[model samples]
Target: MSQLDAIYQLHPKRYRDKIEEESNYASIENQKQAVLSIGSLGVAICSLIIFLIPYSTTIRGVIAALALPIVYFSFPYIAISVAAERRRKEMERVLPDALLLISTNIKSGTSINRAFLASSREEFGPLEDELRTTAIEISGGKSVQEALDNLRKRVNSGLFQDTLKVLSDAIESGGNTAELLESSAEDIRTSLELREEVKSSIRMYTIFIVMAAVFGAPILFSITVYMAETTTQMWSQTDLSGEASSFASGGSTGLSFEQPDVNTDFLVQFSILALTITNFFASLIISQISNGNMKEGAKYIPFTVSISVGLFLAVKTLLGSFL
Candidate 1:
């Protein structure tokens, strides 16, 4: 084979297959396309690193080689993370509008199917998209139940899925679909409102945490700094080297290894960083608890650590005159 043909043969769908392997691309339809998406991301990230590493030193080249795989995997990670975040924001924004739409339609005495169609026609972004898809499917010869199921499956939105499932069940049972839809909408609305109230309350918790990290830590740190300064003054004046070498025979002799000079500066810096990070994380956890989204809260761990530490040190230095 020619060189170009040989290269193609050797690397036949290499990146796509790697993605498939990583994803265990099975059971789900369209998985091959998803794998291809992963392939595109990995190639984009890795190729950039490879091109840049050519001009680097040997050690830098080695570092690039080591980091290449991580970057490749991280590309897909970034894609998934972004998609998930977008979907979450869309769901949250669409929910209240969708509920309001259902309530308005039911109050005006419209059938649920026609109400769903009307909601689709409205320009309320994400909910409109899902309703449009379901409407089109139902209009295109799909059964109402099947269309709802298909819409839920395609969107993979938890709230949307639950709403449709409840409506579908109610309709299938020959029960009052209108009542169920209105009741469900109101219930979801109440949940969203409760979440807002919780957020407001949690702000108070944040103030408590601020008191601990800001006021309490500084006071404690001041005491420690004073003690460190006291020790430094005594150590600086004493003949520590000669006293350091002397070992006593009795158990109470107290001669030990020569202690390193205390650097209050380092302690001050460290205390600031530690207290700040501690406070930041405390606030982040309070947010999670208030929001009722523990899973979402976990991702902010790194942010909380970085912000708290940075803020504490910065603030301490800024307020150094007061201390």
Candidate 2:
């Protein structure tokens, strides 16, 4: 066997099948290599940066070791999943149009396979490609049901798969396919419209949540952190040695003053960490509210985290400079 086939064989059947179904990667070996390359680069970069951290050598080494496998494996999966999601969205956007066109072709007396071919147009994008592929398979003497099933397997869309299953059942039962397609098309459009309406109704809530997470939380944390730093500074400069001497000498009233065991560095690090976590979850919540998919929130994560952390630091610096 060839080297690529040998490498492909190392994967379990289910993993290979999942990659094929969820991604547009034509070659499993190529995808595997791409993932390996991306992961290795990420690990190398992270390893170099980990040494520069102001942490103990043991802590830095531990972090670097843990990051190696995590970054190497997770980054490629994240990239591929994002691409698949974008493709699924594009397919969904064109699905209603493709169904209407297919129904129209059926009304004009074209066979089902021919109707699919007729509906395959550039405007339909990925769905058009799937339709043309299925039509070719049917023309090559493959069973229509098998060809349609293969088409569904190639797409990572639950709605598309469910629609195809319904169509397959209708075909097997000798139902009026054209009317079914038309009704399905109408239903899908209505569903999409209703989804949009729901999103619109919650628009204000989404905005408020985003503003609170990205703006209010950061500002509050910055102010709180600044106060903490100021308190620590003030305590550090205060002459507590006098109080210690007096107390040691058993002199006067029982009041004593000492610095609280507060680490300003730890507090600043904690504030940044809290802001990052808050922004991450806020992004996910916003995505779930607006797009109905939590995975879609990954696109917003960097923006939210960067803005929140940057704003916090900027505000803290401004407070330090002026006050």
Candidate 3:
């Protein structure tokens, strides 16, 4: 057997089924193999590059070790999830049009199978391809319900699945399939429009979240750091020697403030940590507002981190130059 088959066998049955359902590829085993191969190669290359960086050996080794597993495991999952999301979005985008076309065909006195076959046009994208396959399956002696069920399984889209269930029921019950298709198409279009309006309405909240996490937090933290550093410097240069002598001679009350032992390095590190965590959740919130899925926020993480950190460093430099 091939390596892909071996890997497929090693995975649990449920996971294999999920991979097959989500992926657009013809073969689940090949998709898994591609994911694994690409992930492993990417991790290996990254680890080597990290090792060659001009850092302490212990620090470099620690980073490499921690990154290896995260990259190896997450890259494949991320790739698969992104691919699935794109496929689902494409299907959702064109589904209403495909439905209307099928409805039109059926209204023009075509059989249900022929309506589906007629609607398999290039303009429908992946939905067209799926319809073509379903038509072929029905032509090859499978029942219409069975072929549609298979189409539902292969597409793995909730909207499409729900439409298929309705279509299947209508077909089995001798209902008006054309009317059902038209109604389903209208509902899907209304849903898509409502989603877009909701997203637009939440744009303000998304902007607020991003500003608070990336700009507001970083600016506040930088100002705090600057104030702390200034206080420490000013205290260090104070005439504390005279205060100590006066306290010894009872010239004044023995109350003298000493320089705070706040480590600037620790403050900088904490600021970075705070910014990262804030931006991470902020991205999640934005995703939830816009897409209703927290996982969709993953793509924003790198952007959030880079922008927040860059702004922080820039603010620090600007403040340092003035101070």
Candidate 4:
């Protein structure tokens, strides 16, 4: 067996099934091999970069090389999640319209199966595919409730699932299906509008957080660290032997000029680490405020970190040149 096949075989069945489900949502075929290829490429690039860094310690390189394999192996999963989220969002955007169309069909005396099939228009995107499948299942030997349950399971969206569950319950109770669908569509539209309003109201908070984490902290740390380093350098070059001797001779002014014990390298490393952590949490907070999901912020992590670090380096360089 090939290396990817070996890895896939070693992976747990549940995890493999989850990957397959996410892959289906992402419309990706043969995802196991794709994930393996992506992970291997990422690890190779990261390990090479770690090893090639100038003046990097052997221990650091070895540790990074060891850790990167595990970290980069998750990249494909992250990618799949992002793609699936895109699909979910597309379906969500068109859900209300689809439901309204289905309600219209139901009011015109069409069966639920036919209504769903008719609602599977091209503009509905992923929801179109799902509705068509559900209709097909209902037309076959499967019952309506079971087909709808399958539809809910196929979608990894809370809103979609909840809507389907309500529809299923209505079906079981023999309620007015057309009116129920119309009301559900109206509720979904109202919820989406409220979400937009909430986002608008919190726009300033998101801006403040992004600015502070990506711009303010980096600039401040760069200035303070550069000053500390400059102070250390200046103290190192100053002559303090005469001052020490005068103090030893019991001079009236007991003054001493000792070199600073601060390590500039440690300061720079700490600043970078602090900036990274700050940006990471800031991204999550922004995502939570805007999207209501912390994982949605993962896409912003790299962008925030890169911009903040780059700004920090630029500020440090500018200060060094000016001073």
Candidate 5:
């Protein structure tokens, strides 16, 4: 057995026999999880090493320390996040081709398996492999319906899931498979085009989001820089050094009886840092919410935090002359 296959066999499933009876996929799930575990750990360690290192109190060290934690923590997240994203995009890219193939074969009056395998042999991109997997499971004594359902779950794209659900319903109801395949394929193509149309229609908002991310903050940053510099300059001009200087005319030295004892430079820098962190998480949280799954974007939080901090610090450093 493959290492991944072996690992999957270790899991104690509540419906092991039922799953085994329905599909062979459950038999190898443990191995897949084992690979994921190892991959996440490996990514985390590599990121830590690359982003963090032996350091002095130099500015590089400060930046490295600030950046390292986010990168380190996000490494594992990257693996999973990228996987989900990849699966989703892959499904979309290959879906049309799969649909076309299935539709054509069904029109030619082939059995579902032959149609699927014939379609599999074509370059349907990522879906080709998935089709091949489904063929394998069907060959392994599982129904084509069971294998396809499992594939849909693994993909988890709402549209794909809906399509698979429709297929399942058709199978249950003993409907016309060819007609269903043609309709589903046409529906998918229509949905994609409609989505593109909607997106193109609202291209303005995308620009606004980009503007908010890039140009909007710099204007505020310039204002903050001006304020911090003005405050620091004003404070520096006050003579706070002479407790008993010649200017202490009445023994109650005027130098320190009124001046605020806070470093405006440090205050502004700290405030900026805090704001950067807050903004990163806020953006990530909102994106996740918009996508209809908060957990989907949870892994990306650290990466967002890291990049935000980097940008924040870079701005601060460029304006460090004010300090």
Candidate 6:
């Protein structure tokens, strides 16, 4: 057995439906195995590099162990989710045109199967594949309702599923299929336009979230670190001068004070953790505002965290050089 088949056979039901729906052409098991294998390999390499860093052995070991498992599990899910979303978007974009075409063909006295076959154009992209598959299934002795229901099951979009249901009901009721399809097409188009308007209306909020996560937070943290470092240096100098004065005054000056040890490394590590967490949540919020799904925002986390950490380091370095 192939590696993918072996792995999938071990647990066939784990994410099987989602994997099948999201993967356009590849076998679901193969897609799952590819994602898991590549993700694990990449995470292992990164863990090795991290282990080589100057962190304490226990901290590095903990990070490596935690990060590897998290990445291994998360990468496959994220990959599949993203693929599903892209497929949904493509389907949505072409759905109106496909519906209109099918409706026009039906109006021209073409049967439902012929209408779907005629409407399955290359311009429809993924929707075309689904339409062609449905037509083929109907031609091969499958009932029209069963073929259409199967098509709906294969698609991940709620709008497309609803459209299929309306079409199926119209067909069953012997209603005006062409008119119902035309109406459904119009409604889908209107809904898509309204969603676009909503996204545009909330554009400013998205921008603000990105700015706060990537730039504002980093600058503030950099300034705090700079201030802490300056305070530590000042306190060290004060202690040295106070000791000198006390020694010069035959140890009677009484001006010595214990300096607090502010660990810069700890502060830097804390700042990184804080910024990562802050940007992760910020990305989720942005995703929710734009797409109404927080999981859709997970893809933005890496970019947000990378930019925030890079800006933090750059600002820290610039301030260190100047201050």
Question: Which candidate number has the best TM-score?
Answer: 6
Q: Candidate 6: lDDT over CA atoms?
A: 0.84
For model 5, residues 1-323, the per-residue Cα lDDT tens digits are: 97766655664464334333322322234334534464456556644644543333485556656655555434434444445655576677678668777878978988776777778854566677777878778778898778888888666477888888888788778898777877888888898888768667666664564356444554466457666766667877877656446557766535543555566556555555565556565555554434444445555555555655556557666666554
Q: For residue 192, what is the lDDT in candidate 5? A: 84
Off by over 4 Å in 2: 1-20, 24-29, 44-52, 243-250
What's the distance in Å from true for residue 251, model 2? 3.9
Most lDDT-accurate candidate: 4
lDDT of each: 0.62, 0.83, 0.82, 0.87, 0.62, 0.84
Q: Write the per-residue lDDT of candidate 4 for residues 1-323, one digit (tens) a residue.
A: 88778888776687677778888877788888878777777788667756755445977677786778675656677778778888888988899999999999999999999999999999998888899999999999899999999998778888899999999999999999999999999999898899899999999999999999999999999999999989998888888998799787995577777876998877887888899999999998998899887767878989999999999999999999998
Residue-wise lDDT of candidate 3 within 151-216, one digit each (tens)? 887765788899999999999999999899999999999999999999999898888888888899
Estimate the TM-score for candidate 5: 0.65
Q: Residue 208 of candidate 1: its Cα lDDT?
A: 78
How many Å off is the CA of 272 in candidate 5? 4.6
Candidate 1: residue 251 lDDT (0-100): 43
Give the alpha carbon lDDT tens digit for every residue of 1-323 in model 2.
87757865775677656655545622133676666565677778768867766789899888877877787666666666667788888888889989999999999999989999999999887777789999999999998889989988777777788899999999989999999998888888887788789989999999999899999998999899899989988888999988778886896566777699788788788888899889999998998888877777877988999999999999999999999
Report backbone clashes per prediction: 3, 0, 0, 0, 5, 0
The residue pairs in collision within model 3 are none
Clashing pairs in model 2, backbone N/Cα/C closer than 3 A: none
Instruction: Compute each candidate's TM-score over C-alphas.
Output: 0.57, 0.87, 0.85, 0.89, 0.65, 0.90
Candidate rank order under TM-score: 6, 4, 2, 3, 5, 1
Q: Candidate 6, after superposition: displacement of residue 295 in Å?
A: 2.1
Report the number of backbone clashes for model 5. Answer: 5
**Candidate 1 local lDDT, 91-128, one digit each (tens):** 66667667667658867997656677888745576557
